[model samples]
Each structure stands twice: as structure tokens, then as C-alpha cells.
Target: MLLLATGDVIAYSYAPGRPGFLSGAELLRALPPGAPGAPGTPGAIAVDVVAEDVMAEPSWDMSPSTMLELARRARSAILERGFDGVVITHGTDTLEETAYLVDLLAGRAAERGAIVLTGAVRSLDEPSSDGPRNLASSVVAAADGALRGAGAVVCVNDEVHAARWVAKVDATSVAAFSSAPFPVLGRVTGGRFERLSAPPPRPPVFAGDPASDVALIKTYPGIDPVLLTAVVDAGAQGVVLEGTGVGNVPVELFTTIAELTEWGIPVVVASRCRTSAAPLDEMRHGAGLATRVGAIGARGLAPSKARCALMVALGTGGIDAVRDWFRKL
Candidate 1:
């Protein structure tokens, strides 16, 4: 396993009252020789560690630039360094987002090897810390040949999820992530990967830094339209609206959506419901009305992932290009 540690709960102190007590390299070194990610064992997977201290911040502090950099490094490890697989230790807070970004960047090149991300819900000092076990499982999964071409995946709590569908559904549970409305790709058990499904292949979207000025809004009953205008006024390059079931928003926001389209700003409507895919023609008032007014339906994408996709689209091309990109989704 080629381990790239970007820091998070997994790298926190093993002793209470001591912050930054351990580096990712140190954590890997602590593993026994015959362990999943350790070296010097006759048949064990050899681990190569790369620790980027600059990116060693908490997941909430993660930014687009950092994510792009991580993607680049992971891509390099696979395409240039000749690694069969790359495993990343990321903060769980934004692990899904980073995993998706990596998947988008990796594109079809993912067929060459496996790219897996994992993190822990509890810090090392906490009782029953899940970091080591999760990391081991991720390493095991990455090294498995069956996962090649599986695209980027998040391996946590022994479950493997495709990057496109995984979401952090719990704040503190060890089993904090899920890929609802989509079955998990597989699982890691007894130090082996068991494949249950395969993820559909996707072409690479863009290779450059994503635009940072995108805005995401979740609508509620009687929500003010001023919120949309406020973001545009503040120079948001694009907007993703998390509407009610089936991507419905209040009829009051229709005019605003039209005006934004006229002004050349892209407005993508996605469902706020956990499992409902946003379908513009599903209703006449909210989703259909917004569609008629020029809002783009986000298809099956979650609001946050839609925002990431929009950012990548806007960075790569013009309004027409953004529309075409969403159309593929």
C-alpha cells in the first residue's frame, strides 16, 4: 500500500493532553512488520509512506486547493510511481468530498490501480479508537487486485463504498458513512477484500483546480429569495440549491431562478431528501417551474456533490459547458 496521510482524527495524539503527538509516518512505523501496511514480511503488503505536513489540518479546515493537491499526489502515485494501489488517510468530516474529487480527477486512469480513502471517527487517545483498524482495512482493500478500476472508494467500518455515492451520515458513530440508494461496492473482512458490486466507469471531468466561488443553499418553507441574490451579489460563480422532495422549491423563487439564468449564473437544483433523485419534470409547481425558468436538475447527485461538480464544470468551461456537464450526470 502506498499511504498518503493528509492528517485527521487518525493522526491525533495517542496520549491525552498532548496535541500533535504523532505524525502519520510515526503511526505507520508503529505497525508490526507482518501487519497489513508494514514492511519486511515475506508475504505481507509493503507500505510506502508519504506525509504532507502542510496538508495535515483537520478535515473541516480542508479547502479546494488542498483537495486538488491531494488528488494530484494520489494520481502521481498510481500513474508515475508505479504503485498498484494508493490509500489516503483523510479527516472523515470531508472524506467523501475529497474521495469524489479524486475519483473525478482519476477518471478512466483509475483502471490502472485502486485509490482508497479512510479515516476514523474517534481520535487515537479515545477509548476504542477505530483509526488503526480502519487504516488496516483500507490498506487491505487497496492492495486487492479486484478493486482496480473500481474508481476511488471510501473504506471505513470494514465497508467499501464508491466515491460517487458515499456520504457521512453520522457525526460520531464508528459506522458514520453510507451509500444509500446504492449498494456498497464491497467489504473488507478477515484481512481480505470481498467484492459485492462494481461501480460504473466515468470519464475524467477536469484536471485543474475547481472554482472556489460556488454557493450551496438548502431551502426551507417560506425561505427568502434574498439568500440566492445575496450569494450572487457576493460573487458566487455558481449555485446549487437543495430543494425539497424531488427537487421542489417554493414557487416564489422561480423568478429569481430565471433572473440568475439570464445573468449567466448556473443554478442546479438537487433533492434535499436522502434518497430522492432530483427530477425536474416530477412536479408542476416547484421542480417543473424551476426547470421551465431555466434551473438545471441535478439528476441523482446529492447537493454537496452537485456543488463540487458545478465547481469543476465552471472551472473547465463556459455556461454551455456547465449545462452539458450536468446533462451527463
Candidate 2:
């Protein structure tokens, strides 16, 4: 028999402005009849819905403070309310960012229960809407005991990916998210989660909320040095440079990067490419030169995630602390 586990699960929605969007009671009504939490189903999981208006702003409008609060609530649900898992319905635009933030916040508490994020590529009124199916799969993922200690994950199109590596790779396709250079952690098949690969262990969690004064800049041919200085002048406490291959940047920006670090502002270098780690040890070129002057490599993190890590590190400690955190990555 293909038996599915039954437990208490909470679903939080943060998507707004889609036509006839369903959440709360309406969302529960949409779950497939045999799935967990669906009305009239025997042995169904108990689900409580927190509507979008209550939990968050739209994904694009989300800030670090808002995301942190949501993470805290998810943790409380597992540790305090004794819930089996959590599911968040978010906007794809910033879904990866919020998911990653939650992963960071969950930290060691992640071992208690699963935290799964899901969203739709198409709205309810659109042809072949994916929201309801995604939500159902996400709830199942959350309820699965196999997912406990997996940290945060995003479940979409029946695929489960670790929050640390999942990214929004398509704008309009139902198959939108990807975790390239890393395989998915698992998949939802036959109404159950089948583990494919194990995720890496969780990093140390930050007790403080992330800082908002960090800036992310992308380097290009003939990139002006003033762009780096302007953000610092504008009160940016840290910066993540999306540099070229192997984290190289234009030599013209070298002096500005050096100056930022000298002034105690962190300058992290990340690759502009979609895959591979940014070791930044290309000593014969701009990347190595920047490292010599104090720039830190983002390792395997993309710029957006690097910015989140930098913000969290800065929120808790100073430049040396930030350097140490990245060093372990």
C-alpha cells in the first residue's frame, strides 16, 4: 500500500493581485480530493491556512525584515505549535530569495520539521493554472518526515530543491525554477516524497535580522568606478560585485574596491555566470588583484544569495566576521 503520512501542517500565502486568487478557506477547497488536507478525505493531514494579507506583502515588495519575521513564525510553528511542517505560497519573482532567507533563519531548528515554499507560474484564471497542484505537492512535501532536517526547500512542478541552490530560471513556464550544478533534493511522486540526494548541512543561523544597506553591483566592460563609490556614498555598508568569469572585474574598479575595504566596507566578489564557484584566486588578473587588496570571493553563491549572506553576516558582526563566514562557505 502507498500510505501517506498524516500530520498538522500550516500554509501561509504571500501572493497578491492574481485574478481570483485563492487562499485560506478557498485555497483549502482547491486541494485535490484524495490529497492531504482536502475536505472529506480520510486520514488527511490537518491544515491551517494563513491568508496572504496576514502573512506578507507581495514577493517583490518583501524586505529582509518581513522575510525574517516569516522565518521566525515558521520556526515557532514547528517548535512551539508542534506542527509537522510548513508551506508558504509566494511570488516567483522573489521566491528564491525569501526561501533562502528562511533557510538561513531556520538554522538548527530545521531539524524539527520541513519548511517548503511554492508558487504559481500562472494565475487561477489563466489556462492550465499551476497554483493548486503546486500547493498540494508542497503540503505533501512539508508533511513528509523524510524532509525533516532538510532545512528549507522549494517545491514546484512536483520537484523539490534545496533553498540554497534553487533559482528562478524562467519567466512564464510552469517549469521555472532550477538548481543547476546541483541535483534536486527530491521529488513528489505518487503522492509521496522520494529523496534523490541529500542537501548539505545547515550553516550557523543568525540571531539578528539582515542589514538592508548592502548593495549589489554587476561588472561589465568599461564599467565606471563611480558606480561602486556612489553606493558607498549613499550609505551602503557592504557590496556584492557580480564579476565576470572566475570573479574577475575591470581593472578600473580596483582602486575603488580597495578603498571600500580600507574604509571597512565589505566588497564581495561573485560570478556573473549561472554556474560554478567564484574562488577569486586568479592572481594574475583583476580577481586575484582584488583579493590581494581585500575583496572576498562569494565561493559558489550567486550575487543575490551572496548579498543575503553578506547582509546577515553584517547584521551580526563586522568585516572580519563577514570574512570568516564567507571563508567557511
Candidate 3:
């Protein structure tokens, strides 16, 4: 098994007298060499570590280009080295989105090995730092045979969550990541993974590079239509709307959505609420207008995931393809 260190795995001294992250070299040196067996103990199999920077620093400074580069490198290493699994150490801030992107790109490769993402809410210098344990649990989950074909998953705080559904809901707690409206795939307790659900399979969505020109418009009370128009005028190829309950946009924005659809721009509607799926049925006036405007419903996807999927879909094909992809989701 291979453990890929992409910034967050290591602690860095960002400033004087403050908590810090582990450096890649430092983190590698801290781990015991062996296969990850159970959560608390190291396995008997061989484990290797590699360091690469997926971001400039451990903060929320990630770019789409950086994520693509990291994913490409990880994929190459996994395929070329015949590693049984790859455990990625990432920062918690944008881990969910980056993991989803990897899942979209590497889901089919899961048949050969697992791709598990893990990180700490607290830096290594903190008194109650969770990095080492999270790292161990991630390795255990990655090395387990049960994870084969599970696609990309986030293993944090001893819990394994599918990348598509997991969100960072808290900023301080060690147990910050959660999967709602979906049960976790499994948990890593006592140094071993006990499966609760099978890992999901997601095929690659785009053959070429991602367009990366999509925009997310979150609707609030009395938001100006010009904001939506400005996005289009600024060359956004697709848009994801984080609407009110059940995917409802302000009634006034329906015509704007219709215009965008008519102008060949794809629009996806996702709800701000986290619990339920987005139903586009005409049960509400706003949703009814959305249905009429031909905006795609995000189904069970969160806003960020919907944006990523839209970006991939739009870059690969166009409006029709994005609609089909959302329909299936």
C-alpha cells in the first residue's frame, strides 16, 4: 500500500507560537513501516510513503488546477506501481470537493485498489491533534479488501464516508466530517473496518480536461437578477443554483434561468437544506417554475458536488449531457 502526502499530512510552522502542520518528510518519518491492519495497530504488509504538494499551503488556498494536477499524479502512481490502495492526506477545508473530483476521475480504478482521503481538524501541534490516528485509520481502510471498487472515500475521525455525500459541517471538532441522507460506508474502530454499506461506483465523466468555467449562484432573499446575468456575461459556461427548500429559486429568477437555458447554458438546481433530495415536482410555485424553465434538479447532491459534476459534464459534452448525468444521480 502507498500513502500519498499532499500537504495536510505534514505539519508546518506557519507562524510564531501557533499550532502547526506536519511536513511531508516529518509525517512519513512518524509512521511505522507496515501494512495497516486494524485502526490501532500497524499491519504486517509493506507500506510506502511519497510527498507532493497539492496546494501552496494547508489553508483554503486550493485551486482547480492544483487539484487536477494532484489527482493526475495520484492516478499515475496507483496505476504504475500496482499499489493495492492509496491513502491521501488532505486538508479538511476543501477535502470533500477534491475527493469528489477524484472519485469522478478514478471511480473505475477502484476495482484494482481503494482511494481513501483523510485529514485532521486539529493541526499536529495542538494538544488534542487527530492527525496520526486519522492517518492510521485511513491506511487501514485503504488496505482492507472490502474497499476495492469503493471509489473515492473520506476516512476521518474513524468513520468512512463516500466522497459524494460527506461534508465538513464543523470547523473545530475532530469529528467534523459527516454524511447525511446517506449512511456511512463503514467505520474504522479498533484498528479494523466494519462495513455498513458497499462503496459506490462512479465512472469518469470527462475525457478531456475540465472546463472549470462553471459558477455557483446561491439564492437569498431579494438577490438581484443582475448577479445572475453578470455571471453569464463574465463567461460562465454552466451554473449551479443553491436554492430554497426543495430546489426553489425566487420566483423572479425563473425567467433568467429560462434565458440561460435558451442561450445554451446549463443550469442545475440544488437545495440549501442538507437532509432531503431536491424534487423538481410542481408541489411548490418556485419548483414548478424551475421545472418549466428546464433547469436540472440536483437530486441528492449538495451544492458543491453539483457544481463539480456540472463542470465536468459541461466540459465533456454540453447541456444535454449534463442533464442526463444529473438525471442519473
- TM-score versus the correct structure, for each prediction: 0.91, 0.88, 0.88
Clashing pairs in 1: none
Question: How much is the lDDT of residue 119 in candidate 3?
Answer: 83
- Per-candidate Cα lDDT values, in order, are 0.81, 0.76, 0.74
**Clashing pairs for predicted structure model 2, backbone only:** none
lDDT of 2 by residue, 158-200 (tens): 9999998999999889999999889999998887889999996
Model 1 agreement with the true structure over 105-213: per-residue lDDT tens digits? 8864588889999999998878988888888788888888899888899999999999999999999999999998799999988778999987855744565557878
Separately for all candidates shown, the number of backbone clashes (residues 3 or more apart, or on different chains) is: 0, 0, 12
- What CA root-mean-square deviation does each model show from the true structure? 2.3, 5.1, 3.3
lDDT tens digits, residues 1-329, model 3? 66667666335445577545555555655555442522233445434545553444553767777666656655666777777788788888989988888887774466788888888876665676788788878877887889877788999989999988899999888889998767899998866888998655465444666767789989988988778889989998988999877777887788888998888898888887863453565355435468677788877678888887787777567678777766555
lDDT of 1 at 104: 78
Q: Tell how far residue 254 is off in model 3, in angstroms.
A: 1.1
